[model samples]
Target: MTDHNTAEWWRQAAVYQIYPRSFADANGDGIGDIPGIVSRADYLAELGIDAVWLSPFYPSALADGGYDVADYRDVDPRLGTLEDFDRMVAALHARGIRVVVDIVPNHTSDQHAWFQEALAAGRGSAARDRYIFREGTGPDGSLPPSDWVSTFGGAAWERVADGQWYFHHFAVEQPDLNWSNPEVREDFLTTLRFWSDRGVDGFRIDVAHMLTKDFPDPLPSRAELDAMPQDGAHPLLDRDDVHEVYAEWRAVFNSYDPPRTAVAEAWVRTPERRAKYASAESLGQAFNFDLLEADFDAEAFRHIIADNLAQAAATGSSTTWVLSNHDVTRHATRYGLPPLNGRAEKQGAAWVRAGGPEDQLDRETGLRRARAATMLLLGLPGSTYLYQGEELGLHEVADIAADERQDPAFFRGGEYDGLGRDGCRVPLPWSASGESFGFGAGRSHLPQPAWFADAAVEVQAADPSSTLSLYRRALGLRRRLQTDEGLEWVDTGRSDVLRFRRPNGWEVITNFGTSEHEIGEEANRIVLGELRDGRLPGENTVWLALRA
Candidate 1:
């Protein structure tokens, strides 16, 4: 066991995301519940993850995959009872791991009480101020509002059957709250307190940077939504104004005893300014858009890491990053494939899918890729996060046919990328039997990937070379970082490599590019994982503890 160091909790923390519905099934209800997660808390404890960030478990209409929240304080019957959530939290906390929940504040399910009251009372009612509404003609002459499109595929402003316009930034059913309103702001703050009071440690704020849109005014104009969000792209969010809203939220977080965190999805247009939203003014952390760039070359990653450090040094505020989230395809699908059977990887060789026989392994162990990506992911100076199955070296294939796909992003924006999210938000692998894999005795919400049986937790737990073991060691090493100690990024900036130094003389070097690179020798003891004579093969990664 590592020494206790709560000050640097985030630095050494390894967060695991659980998409509540697909983790496991304690009861035979066809849907995963809080009891399922509680059942798996021991599994998480054994895996050595420091926290489990459960996706929203609040009541919802199921539109937009539960993002449309209908009730803020109650647990969805589909998931389980409030009693179940309490038990899950207790179990996780008892194991020394924190629990973070996804908080959707930008909007609420139209079925929520506030919206229901607004609809019943119509315009000029007290509840109408809770949401944003503008006066104008709908896209077609027959509707009641202006031309903003719903994230679900139609106009952002929807006409109540009563000939009144209601606002919905994402889906028509998810009418946005007016953060510009002090009353709405207080209500959301109270909601955060509601959960934090119950024991949730932090929140991965959903559509975070989105809570405040063109307040008093309507959402982005039709022309703005159609344009690409690049360096000079239109400012859909992260305006100089809304930083106050974030400050308000952070202040509330500060009120908690343990100081629970809040991370935002601030996909601002320019890289330089996007880095600024998290200057610790309004939020503890905001998503770094650099990782989402199409050209994820070695030079690109090197530049991104350097730029992130520059921002931290200049602002005195930390930075955060995530390689893959539920919104995008897995790293294996987007960047590179893992190696087959744990063999040393070679360059100029095309990688294939990771599945065949129990022993055949995916053409690649994906370990090298997983190790490479995670090494860089953790080595970065500030807080780091990972999606649910990432620890199991889980790689999902794009098999959801056109008909099976059900992403609100697809229906809302044709200009948006193909339905890429569902593939990423897949079921987690837990067992090895051909029929069960432990998620259940038989069927699941989605088909288990071909490699799941081999990669299943049951199987990996027994193999020392398994990806799960690597993460356990890696995360356990992270837990050793002392909060009072400072972290410095060593500029060994080679195109083929990414390296950084953490507190306690720990360093990790990842080979981001195809070519092999020579990493400088470790000054301290080469403890934990290792690098031989400062050399890392293509896609190979090494982490070491130094004595300096």
Candidate 2:
């Protein structure tokens, strides 16, 4: 943890991330792009987000759905042009919103220029130093230095046509970059400067934890990591001397003004380590997988929050909590259903490409829960990341066929757990008008989700009771509150009910529990909006100001 005494304002801000492929397609090419996102900035500002984070627009093989970077500086032609991004950035800035972009430094596409250089150099070459290589024989004579498995499954090492193995923690096509190399560091820093100069407010550093693995050697088996212990680093993660690499990047990010830097991803595995990374001194912020990993235990959640706050105190660092993002099963599918046979088995309307629609979760129940969830997201401690369409309570889409799926995770792990991301990545619904498929007439990059026809934004805008209206109101309330200056940084009272009382005298209270419960030690003052008894209507909450 660095110094919160002088932390940047973005530290107190909330951000929204848009997966471009699914945001809205203007060209009708079945893909969402910069222009499409620019069109929605007006609506986004209505949500009162501090900034916008557009997933990578870099040119790529689309190997890992854009994580595989073939080129860093250029936008994918399919998405749009460099000018389109310039306009999008300008438009958001015009609205007083800050911005961040994804930077996958841990690795690059195998087709990346650096990787190509390494491939040609083979072993005992300068470029080869940019990646890990081991000399050994395997049972099959075609295996990794050891039996390490990639996050996507199978061996971590992939054989090149030259009979050499390159390591990839994820999909083989997405080769992991070696941070230990000075040249690699220089190149990435230059890239950072390139964008920061372009006015990007910050970055959501992808795989920040894995930026450096001190020594490249054979790793323990998955069984070993899973069996040994959860206390230390999960052997699969936590390589030695990682701090040096982060320190380097931290130094670089610090050199900029307003810092224009935000680091978020699933990197920290333990509280002590999480604190070290999120420490104001190390990296800007880290995405809390703790919240996403929580099973439906209110006590567990209470414990997680308690520990996170305590850790923040321990390191004088910042802590963040998130419900869902582009990578996971949408929150509706994960938390909306009642515990059936010990888990929420009902597929919260997950998309199944060409597999037809799912009616298990209806509009009223789903939308209400969505409203309730968004309320929690905004009211939670620390900064928030709002996934696109979540404001309207979108559900998991149909499971696209394996052949049509683009996510490498789906392709690597086979069926079942490998469900394609199409459900969560489908096009956004923007209007009820005929032929207005989300972002007007442009070629769609992917098939439109079924809700686009009637459940569009225009239809919801006219109805005060619509979820869109709920979102606007929520954002308005968020904008109106301003007591952050006086609140205790690590308050843990009202455990089951996450509570934050701002110096502005406004109390942001949420009921993450299943049943209703009354808060406040005394009679409530004028309710900001309608109230349902002392409790909100099902896991809901209200924003209030105390009256003396």
Candidate 3:
């Protein structure tokens, strides 16, 4: 096991993200609970990750996949009680793995006590002041407050029975909290301390850039919502006032002995705007999604890496890199399709449906690029987040039936196609054959594809060259490198090749072209993953150890 001695541990940590409902099922029920996570502590420790960032397990109605939080203090009964959460944290800590919990401060479930109180107390009450409530437009208060669109889809504003329209950037069930309210700020600070005092190492702030909004009028037009100014001039998102909220949160974080940290899940207009979340006075780190959104081109990867690193440097904070998360399509299936064509985000359900036929997914080709991309990502200079089952090379279950879909965005967004995040959040296959593939005693919540048995942990653990083994080896090797230091780009003189040298004579080279490149004997190297008779194959990455 790795030592947890460094105070700046997060800067170089390899964090594994666990979707609570799908990681493991200890009980006979189909859902994965905190005890299920406790039972799998050894597996995570063996995987060589320094921390585990669990998705929200707070009390919720399961709208927006548990993102619509009802209570931040207690755990959901289906997942387990608050005591079970404490035990889970202790078990992971005993195994040298830190715990980072999801904090959904941007919004709350419609059933949350505050929201319900607001609804029952009617308009012009103090309970209504904690959230963004606005008077509807038009003669009879029938129209929405503004023309802003929800990120999920449709109108961003949802009207209540009290003749007031509430704002929600995501699903209608999630009412956006008003950060301008002192009571709301104080309540969240209390929540932060409540969890930190319970021994959580850090937090993953959801929708970190969108806590504040410009209300009443003069909102951004539909055209303007497509792109905001780089200097944080957006009318509704990444506004100058949002950082004040984070700064207050930073104060709460610093009150603890170890000084807890946070990572922002903000998707801003530009790298400069995104970097503000991780500035010296704000969150410890913000996800650099530009790397995840880039295509499979060598130049695209290099440019994204360079730009992200520069932005993080400007903020005096470490960069965070992630490939697959709960929100977007998994990289395994995404890489198999055509190049992204400069698309920087997941294009919604209808777009995925119109992309192609499901039978044409090049699984083998996708797995190869996924492995190569992982090697390249791990070799970079920052903290890395690995979504659960990414090591298993699990493809997206694209054919989920319409009735089985659960994402609020899929149903509320008015999409006819059954496209939703349920595809990537399918219950994992542990054994090759079993009821639910050993996920639980009952059938999985989302149907696992017939091919999942091939990618099961039991099938891959025994194979030395499997994707799971490669990740184990790569993570183990990554721990030994001077990863937190700066990287020097190597001029390979080929647009399709990316070569960068780390501080400790560790060089990473990836070939995006469809040709093999032979390495000379002068650079006696110990290859990490890709080694084909001293030649690096296309769509493959190799880590080399140069002689000092």
Best by lDDT: 3
lDDT of each residue in 1-548, candidate 2, tens digit only: 21222336565466788998778776666677788888888888877777788788899898877889988888999889888888888999898788799998888998888889988888778987887755545765565566767877688888876667777888888888777689988887788888888888788888766766533345566576557543334444554355566677777788886665666574555776666667666665776777665544446655776677676567655566666677766666655444323434333222211112354544455455555555655654466677887776666665456567677666666222437565677667787553535564753555565566566787878888766777778766666563352343224354556655656666655556666656544327534434555554446656676675
> In model 2, which regions exceed 4 Å deviation?
1-7, 136-141, 214-219, 225-236, 295-298, 338-367, 414-418, 433-436, 440-443, 485-500, 509-529, 532-535
Higher-lDDT candidate of 2 and 3: 3
Q: Clashing residue pairs, candidate 3?
A: none
Counted clashes in each candidate structure:
23, 36, 0
Q: How would you encode candidate 1's per-residue C-alpha lDDT over 76-106 as one tens digit per residue?
A: 9978898888998999999988888898888
What is the TM-score of each predicted model, taking all chains together?
0.85, 0.86, 0.94
How well does candidate 2 score on lDDT at residue 172?
A: 83
State the displacement of the C-alpha of residue 144, model 3, in Å, after optimal TM-score superposition. Answer: 2.1
Q: Each model's C-alpha lDDT? A: 0.68, 0.67, 0.83
Query: Cα RMSD (Å) between model 1 and the true structure?
Result: 5.8
Question: What's model 3's lDDT at 59?
Answer: 88
Candidate 2, number of clashes: 36
Tens digit per residue, CA lDDT, model 3, 1-548: 22345667788789999999998988868888899999889889889898999999998899888999998899999999999999999999998899999999889999999999999998889999999898887899898877877877889899998799998888889999988899999999999999999999999999898888666355556676657564565666788788888999999888877789799998787777777788758887998876566667888888888887888788888788887888767787877887667454345334343223467778788888888889988898888999999999987888887799888666766432347678888889988898788888878877888888999988998999899999999988887764545889988777888999887778898888878877666236865855577777898888887655
What are the runs in model 3 whose C-alpha is more than 4 Å off?
Answer: 1-4, 218-233, 342-356, 414-418, 522-524, 546-548
Q: Point out the worst 10-residue segment of candidate 2 by lDDT.
A: 347-356
